[model samples]
Target chain A: MQQRDNENRLSQEYTNSVLLNGTLQTPKWWPYLVSILGFFVVIGFVLFGIQIKYGLGVTGLNRPIYWGLYITTFVFWVGISHAGIMISAILRLTQAEWRRPVTRAAEILTIFSLATALVFPLIHAGRTWRIVYWLIPYDASRGIWPNIRSPLFMDPIAISTYLTGSTLFLFVALLPDLAVLRDRTTGFRKGFYTILALGWRGNPRQWKMQVVGGILLSALMLPIFVSVHSIVSWDFAVTTAVEGWHSTIFAPYFVIGAVHSGVSAVVTMMALMRWGWGWNEFIRPEHFDALARLLTVVATAWLGFTFLELLFALYGLDAPEIALREMQIFQYPWNMLFLTFLLTGYILPVPMWIFKRIRTNIALMFWSSILVNIGMWLERFLIIVPGLARRTPFVFTWEAYSPSWFEWYILFWSFCWVTLLMLIFSRVFPLVPLFEQKESEVFSDDIKIGRATVPTIFREEEE
Target chain B: MVAEKNRSWGMVIDTDKCNGCSGCVTACQVENNIPLNDQNKFERGRVMSWIRIERYWEGEFPNVKARFIPIMCQHCENAPCEPVCPVYATYHNNEGLNVQVYNRCVGTRYCANGCPYIVRMFNYWEPTWPEEIRNHLNPDVTIRSRGIMEKCSMCMQRIKRGERNAGDQLQDGEIKTACQEACTTGAITFGDLNDPESEVSILAKSDRKYSLMPQLNTNPNVVYLATVDPYKDKNLGEKAKTNEH
Candidate 1:
């Protein structure tokens, strides 16, 4: 009877370890789904090879419409990447209670989106090999450095700074989580976690240091992300071309758009993780409701900007401005796409979020997120092409641009690449940061409130 | 004394004489060895021309009158594009020309953005020239590839060659840009602005001449004489008579 009791106790301890650690018992379907995603990732690589060999001619870009799908994707992906900083830094600063389980997923979006966004400027360059020239400062040998006055010079600086800051912030926050994985795993996984954990032994001083470093990096990244998109908007706003291109409101307009798309992306990502990881208990309806509320606010701001831009254009009565507005509303072939973006992307999402059923429905949220991305891309296209096509004092020459097959393949591949990265990362790291979740449960308001109400906070501990 | 003779080159276009023929446009392309305007690109609204004519409509519907304005780099005295470049690929020459050095450009596109006229065009893709067409290429001018910015140079090579010839013969006012030579009505004139007696200088001083966006204070080297309608008085009188009838 004593031997049997000892055996039972050992088995119970093993089961409890597996449940708490979240590593020893990953879902059976996880590897299979990852492999399927990897297949598309390889396809994207093959397409990228073709783009490098042929040139930008592989895409649908031409004179007057010099930018197309590549630039649109660049802005959209970059905008989507903003979610990580918003979720992690902004919410933490505000002291939102729900951010504990959500921050890791948000940070992953930032990493993957940035990785995807970097490919565009290279693909858009006529001579990809000469891209290094943009990096080198103007010297006697080079004759001149990049003009200090040009937004083109500012683009690379802003993007690189944001990328560096965000990557650092992501890695720093992952350290404690890595330590947990190290203690729980063995073999090659153990080795991977060991190096990544930086030998963190979870000492009191180490935890304090990790938290401080992570907060500092997050603080730095918040403004860096805002400045990144503002500078990009200036790339167009600084130009003296079509009326819409020269607007002063572009910086804030772009930031709101970025947030609109970014929050939607976060919603989609969270939904996918909840379903895949069976994280129903932790992610719950309350989290979805909170994200929905945020989305509604972003959508409202986007609508205000849209109306404000229109009002200014109409009030100014500038000829080029009038022409561009006409083209966007009634004349251009893609006007329908623009309308869809405004209605479905902005208008529809707002009302839907008010409905509790619609907000919590996983499938509805996913579809809405997808529409928001499409809408954002349309917004980028509308901003870049129409203004350039209708510059004043010339016979309006309307140029029709159609992206080539190579361009389509590249875009498709980029989507595959980002998705694959997210999947691989999900398996390698804990999708939900276990340490953070455990802490939240321990120090939750329910426990604190119970202690305050009873005036016996140490009673449970003594018991 | 030499500097005083030809310190600044400029052009003065008589809009009254311009028939909107686009002769100057094609002529500049041929002389400068500019790339062909691909149809696919044109449809996409990307047409690369060093110089272009802009038409503005003054009124709505039947009363509408189209005003044609030919515009290029104003080659401003206080050039907005000059100060913005982190790299000094573009700068003002001693002769008051806005010079863009192709080989030196890293294609940051900041200069293009900085220029209010939007004259700068970026090489977004590799320029393709067929084997036979390559023979027509001028050896004096370097071909620009992708990742470089380009703009109007006021036919600098032609000006230089003409100056060299004039120096050899001890002559003056002997060189002209392709546009000036191609103009049947003599609407376009190019010469050293420093020479008070030069045709361009005299025309630039005309009462009808004005510069576009003068309020911006760019001090553009390019000047234009406003188009005069010969039938303006007749049309007004006829309208008055019709009203009386």
Candidate 2:
């Protein structure tokens, strides 16, 4: 019994050292990676500066095609932001065991991607500087409150609420981990973790409170998660003038699509984390297998929504609506894009994911997840642009949209910015939740029934 | 002079009388201080015309008949662009005019997207004019800057001036919009819909009267009279000859 306890303690110490690699001991390549990502982020800000100074004319936006890549990328990032809540909150409530290792990384992706998503609306506006007026009520002075009916107004409110809630959820989950770092490190880092730990001593009461806080936040954030993407969809959906955009299916379509992309993004992050940190022991093939199964279901549901959107659009049988559909599906460049969107978004990644072998392969999983995002982004692009480009009865006003190189750079910049923030975050905190990993170890056990051994998870009873 | 109570500003456009001269389009640009739309702007699909003459060919080859209709802001009573604007920059006024407040506009282009007529125009760059023609800009109108939406205000400055000039009452013909005044064939008439005796009110009751895209139920103040095409009905031309005989 003494020898067995010693072996368990040694393994526990080994797990702690591996999980806390970034916080306790910085990696050799950390500085180099940060600097490289930092360079790209700086260039992105500079490009934004140029866009502001030169006016929105720098983009390929025109009279009829007022929104282009900016709006598409905005929706994509917001969709990507859905991963955290879907994994950490929804899965937690459902009591999914595999969610433990990925919960933190997914939540971090949610907060950072959401923050990036909020930036696009402001920058895409004609007057970026004047966007500050959107936050406050001007009722006392001008008797003009921001139009509560406007979906654009609702977007910021929903997004900011989600961001705040996600940040709090992240901080709450980080407390015990912070205490771990606080005890392990010295100097500025120790002080940093100490302030954040809030004197979490890991007593029975603190643990109970922490667990309860997480559960309550998970419940609160669920509605916000749904509302954020729904509001984003309404930004386009409420416009009756845009033929393809004004659809009742948009809210659910957007939410499901967001989940599909968001969860895939988490999978991509997990693959990278495993490869980069050499955490093969923690983020095993089983985790990828579980996420892949979740993704297959999500991607399939997303496909059903896509089909429904297209079906109902044709069901109207309106001349303009038909013409718009014809142009979106049959037209030259749009047809190509439509095909690409299908191939990348659903047709390609989903079938590969159905096979157990492909799900367990990290390299294949990474590339397929990346392909899913490419498809999702193209899906948003196809939805936004082709609708705008649809030729109206006023034939003179019909125009095509081609995103400028500047716009492409901005899109690229957004990725760099998100990655940089995530990297910086990883330096301070463990990407995988340490306590959850330890708890999972305790809960997982093998039972031998006759000659067969079955793996099972056992949960502690709540008092 | 008696002040008309609950006056509703409106227009009656006779499409048959419009010859596709595009005079109103030019006049509007001058009167509203619209930025010069050069060849480059046209190429970029950023032309800033407040009023445009849309020409549609009726038939093929020898039977072809060009139909001309001058299109501008319909000024719908239930404007789709109004509610979508986060800043409340555009709204319907008591005078039955769709008003766009320039200073309040943050230019999300959501209003432009909401407008079915494609009348709203966004200023992609600062309004500029060559030094030679700089003095020709209208002093009464505000020159809209870059990164904001601008559209046909129905020449609100002219309406205000016409109201101010009239001591107690405004006449039917007094508040002539820039497009109405410049129309050589008197195709466009501006008047108060509230006054039962007004020409526009009478025209609005005509058999040929219709609003653009009525299916959308916008209930626009600007009514158009469909062109009386004799070629549309072969019997109509024969009936005219027989009646003359």
Candidate 3:
């Protein structure tokens, strides 16, 4: 009884400290970082405005490379969004306790990254004003139905569904935490959390419903997350003329690839939060150890899928396919980037991640995650550009495309946009779920081993 | 109705007669109001040529050979560019022309990528016409706006004008495309394939006729007559005689 009382006190103290972070004064660098990112975000918008006013010629998109860095960035961010549900939903559903501290930060990652991605279709459109024609369901004015067959139509539908579903999931899980803040704080802060809390008094039924609702939402969103990236891949896959794009394997290849990058991004984000916010105790190295093991398996699968695509290309021996492969190897101006993608994405990470020491090192996890995402960005570029370079059999029209300043600026600025929104969001919301964190510590007990006590998770098991 | 179903507008290019000339390219620019490509645009691969003449150099130094082929929109029956269009901006029309709806295009450029012919061109900038050149712009065809995808229409404006002028029925040789009109060597032939009596139908059936990248199964309307080589013929003749013997 005395030890149990001590355990309850320990859990209570940990909960209070975590909860107090939400009420802490805004950090010094917060506004400064926001301002700088906000400035660049403005610049991105201005550049897009210029492109819209002057036409796509302002960017270096020529005849064949109709989709350029804009599309690559779009796919990258959408792929980043998959990280949230994969880490939060799948792990939570499996009852993994490591997800507790990371859940809120990861789910918001989905919201902001997806928000950033949604801007690209508008930015890259040839006629920005006429994009509305695609949104209008009825075809009466346009004289033809928006082609239901096109993967372009599926993107908006699937993305919006996932976004709305995930947002509701985030808010519903957030209520009990908000209720805690409401009871403890005063002034405008009290009123704000109170209304958002929706009058929850930590009632048993409300908690029960919140838990069940979260699981149901997670169940609903899993397929949505998978299909979203698959449909994004189809935008390239259905176009038979672009040699490397029309692939039978693209759908699964894209989904698994997305999962790899998304999980790696979560690891990178957790490492950043550990250092930047000094949340070391909460986001421990042990969390990254588990994540790195997952990353190694995912990277191995990705490597297999990538090489399978290459083998299929070689098998066809089709002229366009051969030409595209040759260009990727020898002719791409950014050949060094491809080499780096192969090294960091598959070659280096695979071997390094196999060792538990490298996986457990926080600094290595940080650097490796960043390298993996960079490799992923290049992978998206390799998938898009080379296919268009050797687009047709006509030798005269076969031309190379290099992204101009506008593309680079927009891509960099989009990163800023995502970072800025996440920073601003961090200031207002609870980064870690107070309720779940306390519950995890309360449920777990140390079991007596031969020489040491190991944590034995005492909870419901799969029947 | 069956007769209408059999009607396929097609083109035949006799590569044997085509000299390495830029007249057809020039005439296409003038007639279609395609913007004059500056050096910067050409360097950037933004050239707006609707129909272009491609020159291929076959051999080194002494036996140097340059082959000129006039390439344009093939208007394929199963066009790779068609179904991929989200807005249906480009599709095969009833008359066999692969029509591009300039106004309808949101400029995703999927059609440009899906085109194996590399024939589809995008307007990078709103095409600027010098004041004097503006006055001479063809009134029959729309000057495509910037941010729209455009390509050779097979002179659809002329096809319509000729059909309208011909009243109830169309006549053979009554209509011709700008490229055909500008080809001084009589290399380009355009006609209705449904009319088996037409010149294009006869040439399309020729032993040497072939479509570009026929293995892709695009069923392109533009058929090419392989260029006849005198030096290669002697080698082929000796091989054929040996096989017979």
Candidate 4:
């Protein structure tokens, strides 16, 4: 009996080690790779500092193309951020069993990406300090409130609300996981985990409340996510100057683009985690295949929207619209870039995902995911700059803008910053929810079938 | 209340007389303290111009006929820009003027989009004034910064000043916008449109007078007297009537 009890304790210890020691077992080569990438991040920061000091003048933005890399990156980062809340909230709502291991990473990505994306708009502002005026209900001596008619005023409200809601949701869902970590860990980790756990015991009442709150927050966040991007689209669509920009199609186009880029980012991150942490056993091939199928659907939706936008433009044939479309397709130097985005962002990814071999092939999926992200960024650029560049009447007024090296460097560094944060997070937190996994394992068919067949018989060896 | 009853501002632009030299564009810029169009800023399509002359080519390259239209705020009776503003930064004054309160503009640019005429321009970057040029800056108009929207106010500061001067002299309907005062060919007329005998009112009633995009139903206060190609009308009799109305 004692030997049997020892065997059971040993099995529990083995499971605990897999859960807790995952980060410690990370290969020595990984840190070296991160440090190398960290060097570029430092370089990006230095360049970004130059931009802040020298003003927007450092970039290549000019008269007709007032908005350039900064605004594009702002939109790109925000779009990428949509993945986290989408994966976590959607999976949690649908009760997807596979979400237990992946949701935390996606949630962290959402929170961090949002935090990073908010900075670009502030950086793009002429007087960054005056941004406070955009906040709601701020009573100034000037007796001016934010222009409610302006989407700029609405942006902060939407983004802040989204940030608050998503962060709260992230923490709420993480509570149970934190409690498990607190009990399992020792030293500084234990103390930190204990505080974060908020003294959550495995009480049924506490679990019920957390679950209920998480559901409510998730439901609230889904619409907020959709609304945030819609508001962003309205920033351009609500304008009268550019013909293509004025279309009603912008709201849905922006949302779909957000989801396309977001899902791609989540897939890319998943691939990296699977490779980096040797999470092959946990993140099975089935997960990748499932994600690829979803990606194909998103790709198709994006493609349809693209064609719809073109069809509407053609049907209207307004002079400005024609000119803008021509500039985007034929006249602009970046026409090739746009064509590539269409081919790769939508076309290439579809076939690869639909084909069984390509979906299962990790390398192909990784490349496709990266391509999708790049294509989405280019898609945003194509939408914004070309239309602004081809404003009505004076064809000679059409001017081209090229981003300066400083802009490029800051963009590179921002990616590094996101990577560095994600790396650190993986180290500190249990990337997989241990208790949830245990609960799932306990409910598996083998244990259930074995229990149903036996009646009150104590089978010690069966352990 | 007494001032409101007698005050109605309007402009009549004679398209035939306009040489399209863009003098009015520069004049309005200088009068309103608009920033210089820096090359870099211009390339990015971020240049700020309160009044821009739009030149439209109506024919093919060899037989091209260019139509020059000077566009600014139309100050429409049913101005589309007014209602969409969440902050009420833009509103129509009692004198039929579409007023843009600079301090109240938070730069969301919804009003700019709502405007079919596309007259509004956003200050994407801070207004730059060279040290020497700072002395030439118009003190009457406030300089705009990035993240704020601005457009031609029909030279609102000039109108206000002109009104005050007329008030001091107690002259009836003497105030005129800067563009009206600067036109060398006497092509632009400014006055109270409500008074039937006013210069703008008489010109607005002419058969040649029309508003751009009249089908849009904006009810624009700015009236354009259509350009007549004299050569095309040469085949008509010597006593051919030039004025349609």
Q: Model 1 - which docking category?
A: acceptable
Among all candidates shown, the one with the greatest DockQ: 2
Worst 10 residues of 3 chain A by lDDT: A1-10
Residue-wise lDDT of candidate 2 within A253-283, one digit each (tens)?
A: 9999999999999999999998889898889
Candidate 4 backbone overlaps, count: 23
Expressed as tens digits, the lDDT of each residue in A1-463 for candidate 1 is 1311331222323322432433556578867766876787787676666655655555676545566677778888878888888888888777676787888888888878887887677766555566566655545456556665666667778877877887788788788878877887899989999999999988999989988988888787778767978988887787654467788888889888988888888888878877776666567676788898898888898889988988877887776678788887777575886788787677767788898898888888878877888788788878776765554443444456677787777778778788878877766777677666666554553234644732111112544
Regions of model 2 farther than 4 Å from truth: A1-10, A138-141, B1-4, B235-245
Q: Give a tens-digit lDDT track for model 4, residues B64-109.
A: 5666777778898888788667666789888888888776665545
In the range B20-124, model 1's lDDT, one tens digit per residue, is 778888887777767878886566455667887776555446655666666667788878777655456789888889988887665545566456676777766
* lDDT per residue (tens digit) for residues A27-63 in model 3: 6677788899999999988888899999998887887
Predicted structure 2: lDDT: 0.89
On a 0 to 100 scale, what is the lDDT of residue A76 in model 3?
Answer: 94
The better candidate by TM-score, 1 or 2, is 2
Where does model 3 sit among the CAPRI classes? Answer: medium
For this target, which candidate reaches the highest lDDT against the unseen true structure? 2
- Compose the digit string of candidate 3's lDDT tens values, residues B51-150: 9888877655666677788899999999988887888899888888789988889988878888888898988898997788989999998988888899
- The better candidate by TM-score, 1 or 3, is 3
By summed lDDT, the worst window of 10 consecutive residues in model 1 chain B runs over B236-245
Real interface contacts reproduced by model 2, as a fraction: 0.76
The Cα error of candidate 2 at residue A189, in Å, is 1.8
Model 2: residue A307 alpha-carbon error in angstroms: 0.8
**Reference-based lDDT, residue A237, model 1:** 80
Give the candidate number with the greatest TM-score. 2
